[model samples]
Target: MGKTYLYLLIAVAFEVFGTSCLQASQQLTRLWPSLGIVVGFGGAFFFFMQVLKELPLGITYALWSGLGIILVSISGWVVFGQKLDLAALLGIALIIAGIAVINLFSISSPH
Candidate 1:
């Protein structure tokens, strides 16, 4: 169970890295960034599959995508000079709260 969460964390990291590289890819026109996208997303999916082995699909995807959204949003702001309005910030906060609720209370979560 602990290993499953570790894998999920890794998967989220890889996915965030892939999404950042996707921006650097310039719509897939560059070579290295494009390769990063391929490798990063591939690694993310691989680790995500490992996570699914121990956790329910719904729970796994929720954690995976939720964390991904938060991290990727921050990455965009920092790395890409993107702006988040108040509404967007509130949405992000809500997502964080949702993830916390799932981790703390969901029965489907791995212990």
Candidate 2:
């Protein structure tokens, strides 16, 4: 359902926020970023729980974590000046392909 995917998108956004804050936290030394970690992940789990009501765990996790990795990787590159070499780019491409396969073809994924 549309609501299910919306919840999943919110969850992924919070997770990406949490992960981005984690990098900015500097090993948890920075105060604001550390708090962001708590709030971001907290919101992530809260909304993710809402999603669990409609979707199976394995499929949800695959989509959640897959999108998270891709977004976080981009955030790291753009916000943190991190590099994505050829191998890393290839890996990310593979991740995208895997997610596409799951969403487009896997019977378990929600329509």
How many clashing pairs per prediction, in order?
Answer: 0, 0
* Per-residue lDDT of model 2, residues 20-109, tens digit only: 999999999999999999999999999999999999999999889999999999999999999989998999899999999998999887
lDDT string, candidate 1, 21-101, tens digits:
999999999999999999999999999999888999999999999999999999999999999999999999999999999
Clashes of 2: 0
Looking at candidate 1, what is the lDDT of residue 84?
95
lDDT of 1: 0.94
Q: Give the local distance difference test score of model 2.
A: 0.95
Q: For model 2, how big is the CA root-mean-square deviation?
A: 0.8
Q: Which residue runs does candidate 1 get wrong by more than 4 Å?
A: none
Clashing pairs in 1: none
